[model samples]
Target: MAIVGGGPAGATLARLLAKDYKVLVIDKRRLDSDPQKGQFTKCCGGLIAPDAQKMLAKMGLALPQNVLVSPQIFAVRTIDINNKLERFYQRFYFNMDREKFDRWLISLLPDEVDLRCGSQFKHFEQEEDAVRIVLTQNNKTHIEHAKILVGADGAHSLVRKQLGIRGLVPREYISVQAKFTAKEIMPYFTAIFDKEITDYYSWIIPKEQHLLLGTALKPRENVSSKFELLQEKMKRYGIKLNKQVEKEGAFILRPMRVRQLSVGQSPIALIGEAGGWISPSSAEGLSYAFRSASYLAQAIKSDFKNYHKHYLDNITPLRRNIRLKNLKAPFMYNSQMRKWVMLSGLQSMQIDEN
Candidate 1:
């Protein structure tokens, strides 16, 4: 089997399945190298949800010190657009380098797993018994045959398009994240919600050396103008934007229909952002990405015929919760009381409770 991504979802799945099957993982970026690690992933920085942490721990995967770039987060500060309501509390959350996290996961793969770093999946041709996969590395083309091809690539995945899997790919938005050099990177995490952006939220996560600021907005919004507003907003917290270091962003997908999970009997599976597993409201995709990869790995090994069933079963509840949150997003943006309710949820995430 060949997996066409080496992100959290793809790498995790490849690692899991490599024990029972011959797996070849392909990625456009070189995972073994680190000169430009973070630049390749283009993630929203490191904010692993509680469920995600539990899942990883259950898998016997402990995060090493080298992967972490910040102290354990004890609290977070959340605010509305106008700065009228600010809520702060000591909760349980942590931060890491997204690319380093990816690198670490990829590095953990057993040597039996064939890791094609810097190799791009050009396309695949489905034969009767197997699929002929095509890839290009260092301008040289190659082909490999595999019974399954998993698309763990992010939104706008080439695998997703080639398979003719449509529906619900419409609700995609742009998430722009940039790095900045600053004197003080806050210990606590900061999240902001603005009606002006209206669809998704923004965040400020502090690494040991840099400040990571990002926003997910509708394609119609002026991305540059939103960055300006974000800068002004950060000033309220005493975070002055310093020399900009680097920037990375991508389109995140939120599927609109169950048909989006419609993968026919073909030897294919779209699991991560490619499968529209991201949150509709928050744009957080990691938890779902990890979970979906696990489920897809199961389907690939045992119930290949029922792949679509497994896919639907895994994502049905997620989509429902996403819809509920999307419904509540506007209220949280428009009403102070509602924003309090939102903050209250975060406030209630006490360490002991967790």
Candidate 2:
């Protein structure tokens, strides 16, 4: 089997399938022994709920205890049109260093799994039963054959385009995120939402040395302008910005149909964000990536049809509902709705009740 893209979804799938299948992971970037290489600019503030942690444990990976910056979610602070504060407190959440987490995950994969870093998937050809993949690494061309191809690539997935699958088109949505090492802010995951400023929310994830501050808006909104607004809010909260560590942004694509998960002639599957497993409303994709990779591994090992049914019946409906609700309530970003939904969901999982 061959997997494209070596992010969380690709790495997780490679590790899961390595035990039974000869897995080869191809990526556009080459893996360096240097730790810095794994520290790519991520838009996420790196807040993972306890339920997500439990899911990771089921996959034989445990969340690092010491990596968390804080665990005190004092309140869900929301700003109204009049700039009033609405606070709701249930429980605390953990903040992590995304770079550290990604590096750790990559290291957990077994040696048997062939990891080809800096190798970009140029294209592919489908035979009767297998796929012949073409890749370019260091200006050198290479070829590999596999019975199944898994695309764990990010939003701009080459695999999705190559398969000619019509799902969520590009430019449908956009989100901007930045990581900074600032003076330690409150040891909490605080979200501020307002419509007039930006049709999205801002987050502050306290870390050991600094805080991860980020803001996101839809494609139609001015992201750079939103970032500026986020900076001003940080200042208003007395959150000192020490230095800009990293900055990155990406388009958020919400697939209109769950069937887009299957995007190939056969023996090929798209997992993670590439598969459109992202939550349309919250734009949260990491947990979905982990879950999709696990499910895809199961299908590849047993029955492919079963994989489709399980994903569709168990997860797709909820995602669809969330998307529909988000479409109907675009004003959710106007107030405390986003934070409320997240807190409510976390509370429902007993993550906050405890």
Candidate 3:
């Protein structure tokens, strides 16, 4: 078996199947060594939400302290710039360094699995009984064959493209984020909604001595200008970003319908964002990644020949959750509805001014 991508989904699946199968994981980023070796660290809020925490508990995993970042979040301050309305909602998130977190997950992989870092998956070819995986590392090409191939690769997944299972693929957006030196830290996360900027959303997450300000923008649009505008708009709420230390961007998937989700056919399967398991409204993918990977692993273990059927059967709840989130999207994304919710203070909490 071979897995492309070493993110949470791939790593989790590798860990689960390592003991059972001869697994090989190909990841472009060198998490085991210098992550900065010409690799793009994913752009994310790096918050481990309650759902993700629960998944960890179910997996019998406990996060080490080194994975955590400072100013632990306990609330989310949602702001609607158009209505000048803002509300606080109780939420808990473990702020952690994403790269380090991925590295830790990879480190947990058993010795049975073959781990290949800094290796890029070029493409794949399916034969009669086995699949051919082509990878490039250090400008050299390598080919390997596997009976089962899993695509835990995230949005913009090449494996998904190769599957050619055509339906409604999830909508794609470019997420741009900048890390600025933090003069101070906020105790909670910030969610910003401004229709003028984007119908998606924006966010501010503090990571120890650095503050991250990011927004989801329509791809190919003036993303740089929009990001700058987002930074300026944040200043209105007294969230002035300090000198920028770094900037990063990545593609995020938004599944508007359950039909958009594809777990892949036999021989080739997908998990995490590649399978459209990410949340439609919040873009929270960690929980979905862990859950989907777990289901796939369970399916493979239960029945290899019928793994696809079992995988689909196991993900019924996940599909339902996506539908529920789709149903809730309007109340969160629609300006009028969101304004009403904010004005009504629905499900919102009042923070002590003192």
Candidate 4:
């Protein structure tokens, strides 16, 4: 079997079946080498939720100290722009060195699994018994024939496009993850909500030696100017995000259709953001990516005939809930509704508001 895109989803799927199958995992990243300081993945805040942590531990892939960027966060402070309402939630997320995290996961894969990093998947042609995949490495082209093809490639997935699936309708948001210096990175996360800029929100996530500041813009427009606006808002909260050292921007995959998972027949499957398994509320992909891959691996192990149906049966509710959360975001935010929510016992970290 062949898995394209050696990300969290692909890596997790490979680990699950590698001992039994000769899984070939391909990625453009060089997973074999050690990363220099200040290296991270593109378009990633590198935050993992509690559920994802449990999943990793259960899979026998414990997170090492080298991969952690920050300690477990216990709370998130949220600020609304309209009325300047603020609230604190007990929920939390863990941050990591994105590059190191990916490498660590790659290390957990069975040595028997063929991990071909620095290689790119170009295209594939389906045959009677196996699919022939074209890949390029060191400027040389080669073909890989597999009994099954798994598309774990990300948002701009060539696999999805090749399958003739329609592009993300209503489109997705444009977001940027920027790193800035801080005196000491806090354990807590921050969310700044402003309807003027975006319906989703902006965030300040703590890391080991730096902080990650990011924002998502809806289909309406990009948030370059809004990013400036965020810097100003952050100043009021005593967080100065000046002189951005590094920045990466990309399109966040928003679910245009709830039931969209795989586009091809039995032997082919789509996983991760390629299948639109991204979280609707936060645009978070790791948890869903891992979950989708887990389900897909299970089905493949059971029976290929029941793969699609089994996956759909298991993931239908997950997609539905995300759709509901996306629909509720606009109404749940905004100044008018927030004013009432604050009055209805919402807590705040901002002392002036108290």
TM-score winner: 3
Candidate 3 lDDT over 1-354, as tens digits, reads 999999999999999999999999999888687566556787788999999999999999999999898989899999899888989999988999888899899999999999998899999998999999999999999999999999999998999988885456898899998999977777789999998789899999998888899899999789999998889888867886779989999999999989999999898999999998999999999999999999999999999999999999999999999999999899999999998989998789989966
Question: Per-residue lDDT of 1-354 in model 4, one digit per residue for the tens?
Answer: 999988888888898889878899999878767855554455787888876777776676677888876656878877777777677777757678778788887898978999998899999999988999999999999899998898888877888788877544325678877888778756678887787767777888877667788988764664677777777767776886656788888777777456554534557788888777887766778878888888888877777666777776666666776778667655456568667876575554442322
Residue 163 error, candidate 2, Å = 2.0
Tens digit per residue, CA lDDT, model 2, 1-354: 899988878888888888887999987654434445544444466766654566687877766765565544544444343345444445445567665666567778898999887678988889987799999888989999988788888787888888877544433456666666765455456666666555545666666666667665676667788788778766776668777776677666655444444434466678878877766555567777787787767666666544555544445544564457457554455345545555455333222423
Instruction: Please report, as a residue range, the 10-residue window in candidate 4 with the lowest summed lDDT.
Output: 345-354
Clashing pairs in 3: none
**Candidate 2 C-alpha RMSD relative to the actual structure:** 4.8
Candidates ranked, most accurate by TM-score first: 3, 4, 1, 2
User: Candidate 1 or 3, higher TM-score?
Assistant: 3
Per-model C-alpha lDDT, please? Answer: 0.75, 0.66, 0.92, 0.77
The candidate that wins on lDDT is 3
Better of 2 and 4 by lDDT: 4
lDDT of 2 at 293: 80
Per-model TM values vs. the true structure: 0.87, 0.80, 0.97, 0.89
* Candidate 1 backbone collisions, by pair: none
The lDDT of model 3 is 0.92
Once fitted onto the true fold, the runs of candidate 3 whose alpha carbons sit more than 4 angstroms away are: none
Ordered by lDDT, highest first, the candidates read: 3, 4, 1, 2
